[model samples]
Target: MTVQTWTFVIVGLTFALYILIAIWAKAASTKDFYVAGGGVSPLANGMATAADWMSAASFISMAGLISFMGYDGAVYLMGWTGGYVLLALLLAPYLRKFGKFTVPDFIGDRYYSNIARTVAVICAIIVSFTYVAGQMRGVGVVFARFLEVPVETGVYIGMIMVLFYATLGGMKGITYTQVAQYCILIFAFMVPAFFISFQLTGNMLPQLGFGGKVADGTYLLDKLDGLHRELGFAAYTEGSKSMIDVFAITLALMVGTAGLPHVIVRFFTVKKVSDARKSAGWALLFIAILYTTAPAIATFARTNLIQTVSEQPYASVPEWFSNWEETGLIVFEDKNDDGVIQYVGNQEKNELTIDRDIMVLANPEIANLPGWIIALVAAGGLAAALSTAAGLLLVISASISHDLIKKQIKPDISEKGELLWARIGSVLAVVVAGYFGINPPGFVAAVVALAFGLAAASFFPAIILGIFDKRMNKEGAVAGMVVGILLMLFYMMKFKLGLFGGGTKEEWWFGISPEGFGSIAMLINFIISFGISRFYPAPPEDVQEMVESIRYPRGAGAATHH
Candidate 1:
């Protein structure tokens, strides 16, 4: 088949597969919709959670960012994967024992306050919405390439596709669909990495390829660093970011990963607290495969681009580079009228510009992989984007219908009415998320950046302390969430948007970037929450008993339909 034909075939088959799963696994009640009947196997839940995590950011952007940032990008590799350690140990099992359908449900019941639940619901919605927008943007990128349409139009297409599965099958549909997603995405990712590794370094293992000698006999990274300095760029093996900033960013991502509502909700779907713990182990194991291979891919892509394009005649540039040029992802300008592309660090001297986000998407074409492989990648990217979008939308809808409306505002709401409202809420969220995809904010470089910070600031502290600290009261939990999220929003708007005036990293508080500020903001949340408990009354006796019970490994049961 032709490239376009191949793309359509693969992409169509994947969508059909997801639709079939959604139809077969359609949710029957609120419990099924929210937590997949709370009986999913540990292995299945692990695969589902892995799919939720190996999102647009992981599949598309993380390796791409590392391509540009060199060792500075280690933050993402460590930060994201490290959070599961915190999750599996510090949070997931305990939350699973609490026997709630949602994170807000835990907060609400633990604090014994409707107001705390409301605050948690709002945080979940905001974070999930922010996260879904990024996924929509990823879908737009894939659709734009395959359908030959504007990215905006493609985003709307992606939104509608996710809306159907999410509304029809709810959590049950999303979980099984994600299992399929894990297979497709991981296969697509590994194939290209292996192919490129063999072509360049005679090593099928991308991990070994990074360390192995190339045809020229110099170490690959050494050659890359040499080429980088030759082009007036920093060494590829060394990081240029400040140490403190790296520390803060890594810390923020770690906590943020543990705190994200969509991820936390996955543990709730498993059959028991033991399953939650085992599922987390499985998740980290699977995630590590991709994580370990990414740095090698980043190194290879950077080296290949420098060697292939630097100082080459513009007229002689490869077909892949030209193709991306048409998409505006790669740009070349002959500033000196020499008709040659001088890709130096300085824009005045460099004749080519490449967007970092396109690194992974364009890698196959750069390596001259087969058409079917390229098409498979396009399908894989779509799966990564759509699966995560469906997961996030589920949490967004549940937060609005189940947590906010049914529990707080209309306690007497009918089951059918609440499920209907959940579907409606998903439509609204998808539409809003699509809008963000079309007209992205200048500062929203990666969806993971903003979403992680917001999650770290708002939910991480409240949930952690609520689980461990038996004395944590409603006032403290609510106050911490409100203060932390508002502070994060204030910083992001002030610095990222330049709302009041121009903002830059130079004006950052003690050199902390907005992404890293979440770590500090979370600290303030911990302090304020503990401080509030001193003046206010403690959690009720029964609420304290609930906290104590959550610490145990036994007695996990399926959450009933409200």
Candidate 2:
């Protein structure tokens, strides 16, 4: 069969599997829609969570970022995964034991203040929406390349598919479909990594191959580092970022991962607190399958790309070069009119635009791999983006319909009416996200970082304090959230948009980039909240007892009190 034929067959089979799973696991009640009826097996929940958490950023952008950033990208790898340890150990089980439908629901009731809940809902909506927009853009890019559709058309197709399954099965359907997606995406990711690893280093294991000697009898990493330095670039294994910036970015990503609502909600699907813990361990294991392979792919792709393009005449480059160049992903400039593509990195002499997002998507092409592998990657990218987009849309709709519309605006709405409104909210959100994907205001990865910063600064402190500290009052939680969010906004505007004034990172108030500002904002939040709570009144005695009950696993089955 032709490669395009195989592409059609593979994508068709995957979609069919997703639809079957959705039909088999369709939700029957509001509870099932919200939390998969709270009966999912830990292993299945773990797989679903892995798929939901590993979005387009992980599948497409992460390896690309690493390929370009070299050692500095390790922060993303270590920080994102390390945060899960915090979530599993400190947050997930307690939140599951609390037996709440949403993160905001737990915070509001725990602190005994509707205002606190409203702030949390707003923060959740902002984080989820910003994150989902990038996922939609990933879907568009994948479809535009492999499926031969317009980017906007690709987003519409993704939106429709998500609506069909998400509205039909809710979390129940999403969980099963995500399990299938995780399988497809992981297989697609690893197959290319293995092939490329063996081709480059004659080693079967990608992780070891990354550090092993190349076919030319030189250590791969050492060769890469030498070439980078010779070309006026930073070494592949070392970075130039300040230590404080590195520490802050790592901390921000760690805390942000713990604060994400979709990831936290996965714990609610498991049956018990112990199961939640087990599921988190399993989720990390599944995630590691991708996380560890990504760096190897980055190394292999970078080496292959540089070797292929370094001396090739610009006009003689392959069709793939022209194809990607048309999309503005890879551009070339024939400085000195030599008509040869100079791939060297000269800090002062070279001016070329290479979008890091192209690293993974163009890897197979750069390596001259079979067309089937390239097509499979396109499907995998779409799967990653769509799964994450669906999860984020669910969170956004729940914030509006469950928290704002039902709880605050109209408490007497019927169950059916509430669900209808939720579906409406989902559709509206998808439309807005689709528009932004086509007309993004910034880079995909950078936009996602802003979302993480916002979530970390606003929700992480509130949720952590609400669960673990009995002395925390509504006043402290509200004040902390306000202070954290405002501080983060100030940092982002100063660096990201230059709204505060004409300034750059070199002139940052404390030499802190916006990307690393979340950790400081989170610290400020913790200090302010804890300090004020000490001076003011504590949570009521009953609330304190409730907090104690949530820490234990035995009483989780008790009927939830409104």
Top model by TM-score, which number? 1
- Estimate the lDDT of model 1: 0.86
The candidate maximizing lDDT is 1
Clashing pairs in 2: none
For candidate 1, the clash count comes to 0
What C-alpha lDDT, on a 0 to 100 scale, does residue 241 get in candidate 2? 82
lDDT value, candidate 2, whole model: 0.84
Reference-based lDDT, residue 189, model 2? 90
Q: Write the per-residue lDDT of candidate 1 for residues 1-562, one digit (tens) a residue.
A: 6777888899899999999999999989988899888888999888899999989888888888899989988898888988878888898877877778788888888888899999999899888878887888888888877667778888988988998899999999999999999999999889999999999999999999989999999999888989988899878789887889999999999999889988989998887677788999998888998899899989888888888888888888898887677666677877899888889987678777787877887888888889889888898888888989999998899999988889888999999999999999899998899998887763123666878989999999999898889988889888999999999888888987888675887889879988798899899999999999778988778778777777753435542222
Candidate 1: worst 10 consecutive residues by lDDT?
553-562
> What is the per-residue lDDT of model 2 for residues 289-404, given as tens digits with 9 covering 90 to 100?
99999999999988887777776888788877877776656778777788876666674456467888778888887887888897788778878888888888888887888888
